[model samples]
Target chain A: MDENPGLSEQYRTASPWPFFIALSIPLAEAGILFNLFAVAVGGLLLFFGCCAGMLQEAGYVDRPWRSLVVGAVIVLAFGGLLLYADTQVANEAVQLAERGYAVLVAGIILFVGGLLGEVFVDDGEFAV
Target chain B: MQLNGQLALTILMGLFLVGVFAWLTRVENWSGYTPLSSGGSAVSGESGYVSEEKPAGIVRWLTTVDHKDIGLMYGAYGVFAFVVGGLMVILMRTELATPETVLVQPGFYNSLLTSHGITMLFLFGTPIIAAFSNYFIPLIIGADDMAFPRINAIAFWLLPPAALLIWAGFFPIPNLIPAQTAWTMYTPLSAGVGQGNQMNAGVDLMMLGLHLSGVSATMGAINFIATIFTERGEEVTWANLDIFSWTILTQSGLILFAFPLLGSALLMLIADRNLGTTFFAVGEGGGAMLWQHLFWFFGHPEVYILVLPPMGLVSYILPRFAGRRLFGFKFVVYSTLAIGVLSFGVWAHHMFSTGMDPRLRASFMAVSMAIAIPSAVKTFNWITTMWNGNIRLTAPMLYCIGFVSNFIIGGVTGVFLASIPVDLVLHDTYYVVGHFHYIVMGAITFAGMAGIYYWFPLVTGRMYQRSLAKWHFWLWMVGTNITFLAMILLGYGGMPRRYATYLPQFASLHQIATLGAYMLLLGGIIWVWNMVQSYFEGPVVEDGDPWDLEASGLRTVEWDWFDRKLQTKIADGGEEEPVTDGGVVEDESADELDTDE
Candidate 1:
């Protein structure tokens, strides 16, 4: 038997995405804790961007923006439901409306960004 | 806007450090042991898993997925957390010396109390054990790396952020005070009912941090389980698998079952705090007892999850030092599995004083009492393994012996608390505090030290200062008993726990405990100094078998790997001839090696 292997025989020796993803979560948490709209929005942007990068690097998808489009649609639907609950339900929790609005805005941003990336980055003359 | 600026400054500082690091990597003069993508690539054999041209310096630690590197990072992180937790307790102990909140305000004292408990258990205890398992498991099991390397890295990466979120209350953020709900975070008060800072978003941040930690632990548990199941070598079967691996496998199982429940409960509590849910609201559908039930359901198993690996460590290391195979090896393995399975059934024992149904309480009491049998069985085997054997009085062995002694005290006290009558009296008292500190600090941390000292040569390629190690061990042993025993006596005097100021009757014992904590702090400082100094300047271990394991016929696979690496280094003209400094150069027969039970 081999006493030791020459090196870890694995693909993707290193990636910086996990570090950014880790950083983003606490930033998002800080935003929610302190009621910072801009900080929260920025954190979500970095969070999703890093996640999309990771999936594409792992070859989970050929185009990160395409998968993000699906993610955007799903989050938008969930956000809309939360908004409806805040408006229609009598026993809604505190800040349920604010949380819904935040999620809705995130969904809108992701949807627009994904479409733009697909048009400009993926379908461009110098597409990766 | 100030808060925003602070955040920006923090990000800027982080980027500055990264930039300096990137620049330093290009500077050849800034070198000592620049780790390759794989941690040990420099010493790895031609046939060993060595990276062709791995990134050096900070980038290696930041992004590398190698188990050994990850393990080292876990060790460093756990040590840092331990230091933080230790300092918090030292401050609390100082405050408790006179029991009038002399050192800080009662609110901040409460924050320190909450942070200490969570930090020790979640941050130090679990991750320190993870440090050993992550580093050693793949080596012992003959795996190239952990089953999912990237996922393993992600699991560890989650911790720093989790720590930030958990301790955010202590940071200079506006209106974000630390949580005083205690680590248990019992409901009603935890649902922002208290006049204290519990109503602030700090408690919510703490819960989120706790949730992130739980998620991280769950992911790590899955990785360990998958690796152990799929990665063992051909010769490493269930019958012959090492004891440390067995304990870790069992600990991983406990984590898989326990931490997710904690995550869900934490989420529910956070919702109650931030989203105004009635999940834990006192007058609403959810009641206070629900939180107790859920928390302890995860919490009690969490105790075992923190402990079993230490038990494994002592069992593995004690045998080598005792010059014999561990007696009843099969029974130790059986007891490990038994403890893991029975740990779940006894979570309600923590809820005995919660006024649950008498019948349910009795059943929980029985299971709790029964679970002690497996622990005692393992202890019995450890002692029996050392019985009539040539015992070495090394630092690691002393700590292993200390582990058993402390486990006995801690386990017996825990057993008394399992009884309904006894628990009703001792619940929320200094006695309960004494009982767990005995296990967590006395037993578990001792075992961790034993493992660290035992593997010092293997990890650092140098021997630690023997005299300093002994002093460190002796101080901690004396300090642990003095501090904890005083707490136990105070418990008998009807002293309550978690109070910044106590009745004047408890002053003498409190002072004595504080004295003991000072000793522990001294010992801890010595240990850190020894580790740092020894790693860089201590005598190099020229031989593979540093402890002369072959003399006792107790050499294991990891040592075999070490020996092969040393030989390869010599063959490639890498170093001088092996120096005879208590290490044996000759190898034992394969049959003799297999004689290790």
Candidate 2:
């Protein structure tokens, strides 16, 4: 953990910026470039997972706990909804996969939101 | 034969783009080089570039976050866009010179229309308002700078690439079906349906460009809103805030609500085009009307977004030129706010013919008619402002007068179209086209031209040739009336718009419109010439208040700064290039305060 970071170092994020950037590109190029959006989503997750270890290393955000907690909560809530829709919800009411996908997207968006929220400012310690 | 040539051209264009990217970024070290970090003069001023050096040459402009510099750039960029858009319209008018195609293919005409519409609205209209807003907002509110400086720079730099992307198909691409869906880019036409070039590659580019514009505008809105809220000087109260800043504040709020939705809609449109989605694709449980709903929602407010700041400009400028106080000042402000509130409500008037519902149409019609009240109030205020005052028939005043006069024609036509029965008859007719152009080119553009002329000395420290400027004003007055008035007549004669060819009966009006267009084109040429010649060769305005209203005590903060800046430039630019080593440029005055202050 560097105490005083340069501009280049300041740009490094605990949030998965690279994953988001890459995922957006491939998704926009869908049908024209490639039909395999699952690949893009998978690659984004993998990239994020690989970079998640960097959260321990001090970057923009010192604590990184709020983003992690918020992300976890979002995933849990939407994940529960998806589980219920798939297993318990009545058939012919809604397409479980589509609902599940939408919920999954919502969960990830919230997760990213929380992730970025941690690093937006240097609020490392809680205010007393 | 065509196939081989197309493939070769494709390869060539691909390589050219690769070369351009490499040259712009890597080869020239353009991106890596810092423009602002040069050890130049940083000035401390009451309401000016406080923390920044006066950057040298191109870097001074490129890296400037100073609201004044940003404003100048916006003004310059907008003028350039206006010329380009004007040229496209000229070509269209040339084509419409006769019943048959006089100059271009039908495809080419469609592309021209598309380019002209987008460029006029997104490129010329918005940025011109920005030109005034960025420059005047802080000056009027007594703020030193915008709330976010870096964000301001970022907002401006987004425009060039957006403009380039929208016009990409004009280059020698392999399958260059330049977007002909018009500026509306209505879906099913723009979506990958019915085959042909309707699913043109250019449509995708235009959509992306539109997306970038939305991004720029939204960022600019955020900056404007933040600045107006937070950056008012201690002396300036909300009650005392100038009309220009007030309108900008309201316009920014509208932009905040309106532009993001437009951006989202554009992204969905892009996806529908290239990503095999059917958000607005017809008959796939998706409807074409969805795009119309999203578009006109932003679209209706977009007209106000273009006109409001200029309306504010007229409110500010007319009084100055007329040598009188603006009558009904509070009422004008109230009306401005009312217009802002009602702008969101009247977007559905554009969709009355879309067959939505009778009740919805009725409500929208009511709101549309209600929206006209504020405009009428402002017009009344303006007329009252000019009534008994010693009106100076200066170039800017003439344009202001032109603005009010032409706005009457444009506004009155708008009320007629606001009625559902009238709109049902005139929908997609040249009447709608006439109404739109009158507001856009007549009211908004006329006011914009007035602002440019009025602020020419203040912005550039030079006054334009008055004789040439008068010619520009008079010609514009005649040309706009003749052209747009003829359009109303063409509509009355049951002529539909967007057609490359028309019936022989409407030919006479189209010819008259074309003749007037040529006059307008000549005036436009004079405008550019005036700006270029005036900036380089025109007499330096030593007296800051070139209008000579010093004794009248017209309270304008921009003139105060303008006076000081001219002193600095004239004083420094005359004898010695000031010592740039210490990172500050000081005028040769003992007192640092502006004379007004």
Candidate 3:
């Protein structure tokens, strides 16, 4: 296991990406109502995947890795859905549809990422 | 805000008067000194009580510093508070028993529920444990007295007024308002708006009183830390310190950090309430989230403070009855420290739904999950201690077993709440109530009972009636489980806590819980009767290792010192010749050997 300093620094480095995604997507989707929800969902999925990766790297958990994989997949899926939703909104027949698709995609990715990250981490050495 | 300014000034004046009076008395040497005594009678010779003896009246209790006297005062006061809090629960249960309100107005019922939660946690649970620790830690550590006896007296004195302030809302004070804010005192709700806003003088008083309680607790923590660090006998080394003392040391350390934060938080709230500060005022540059941050910072550790000593007591006594050394003493000690540190980081899990940054939420979830590791380690050590040993199902052991079972359920449910999504659903619901009570009521209270039973003979020199003790233990175990389990189910079904009346769907569960509460009350009454009767009428038992069949023959310093002291007193004609089962003479000779060494 890494010493406290190393582990803490590593944890710090790994933590910021999730916040970045959460913050950046809203700005990126500004004035583009069709795919806004999808962009938000994709950002959320990326955040969960980062958490899983950090937990694993810190040696704080042992788990199935399914959550991490799922989180990654969700990020990708939500990005695609957001793109599709943006097109739908531009078509103007279903402006709200884009945001709904984004939200659904984001939720799935983050959920899967969290689960996989927890499952794959090696937490035994730090067991109390 | 106008009313709060006046109340705050009044409290400040009262505190200043107390400080001045104490200082003046000390300067003039007009202070009456009361000596520590076994009971009401004064101890003769060098250890004569230091407290001033006055007319055997109300003032005697107010100024007494004798640890035993203070302990009894705490015990009686805690029981009274517990009964009051329990009655509130009973009222809440009755209101929820049907869809309609019965005994009180909705506002009044909310007050009852709020007071009940705060009173149970702060007044009843913590004080009862403090009572035992105050009385026994010195005795068990082989110290003649606490390191700071006068401060100890002051700590006990602080409780009554604080309690009165919290409950004072029940009475009609011409200008005072009972605080309608929940016990957590969430911001904006607690910070009154300028004129035309609803306000209560009672709320301000409660906040001031809470600040006093925090001060008193911090003082007690300092005393405990000093006593363990400096007051241990010359012969006692760190490793040789009894388990109970070790627990006190760690718990005290936690308090040293935890209580001051509470003090500061209360002060900030006071400023906001009275000085027009914007620390917690929503918008206008203050955030409601700040209160959650500050409150939980101290609040989570507060739970550990409540549970740690009881855990220590259980660790101390369980091995004696098991007829073996503790399974992993160092492991238990380390895990305690680990838990104390880990507790600070997990407080944010309580704020999962409060809309903190999601990354912050995830970090909190990870830390919360990590706490389970140390807690699990402690649990494993306990199980290994009891595994395959000569287990005696004594009353104390029964309570210990109950503690383990109840705490496990508490711990498991706590895990469920750690998950962010899960907490989003359960936050502020009855489930949260069930989770805490299981730990506070089940684990801490169970540990308190265990300590009382284990030490009763030593304290009073009399054996409690065994049959009656058994009945009390069984009833309490059943009543505790029944009462809390129903609440857990109700909480899962989305029943909101602190509500006067619930929907009809929750009626059956509420009725069940109320019935269980009656059983709990019955159990408590029986326990009081048992203790009282045993003190006066039970058969006398000579103090020794009363639970005699230990594998290593009671190696702790408390046993060694107590036996040595009892023997010397007999030889010096300070005590009678204790009747030994095997007719062994007192070990006064051991004292001579020690002197020669």
Best by TM-score: 1
**C-alpha positional error of residue B14 in candidate 3 after TM-score superposition, expressed in Å:** 13
Model 3, position B55, has a per-residue lDDT of 18
Off by over 4 Å in 1: A1-13, A30-35, A88-93, A112-128, B1-52, B571-597
- CAPRI verdict on model 2? incorrect
Determine which window of 10 residues in candidate 3 chain B has minimal summed lDDT.
B46-55
Write one digit per residue (lDDT tens) for candidate 3, span B345-437: 998998999888999999999999999888888788788989998889999999998998999999999999999999999998989988988
Candidate 2's C-alpha runs over 4 A off are A1-128, B1-54, B567-574, B579-597
User: What does the i-RMS of model 1 come to?
Assistant: 10.6
Candidate fnat values, all:
0.17, 0.00, 0.00
Total backbone collisions for each predicted model:
7, 1, 32
**Tens-digit lDDT track of model 1 for B509-565:** 999999999999999999999999988677767688999999989998788777776
Sort the candidates on TM-score, descending order: 1, 2, 3
Looking at model 3, residue A72 earns an lDDT score of 54
* Model 1 lDDT, residue B74, Cα: 90
lDDT of each: 0.81, 0.73, 0.68
| TM-score-best of 1 and 2 | 1
lDDT tens digits, residue span B133-209, model 2: 88888777776667765557657777876787788778888986679998988877877678668777777777777
Residue B56 lDDT in candidate 3: 36
TM-score for each predicted model, relative to the true structure? 0.87, 0.77, 0.71
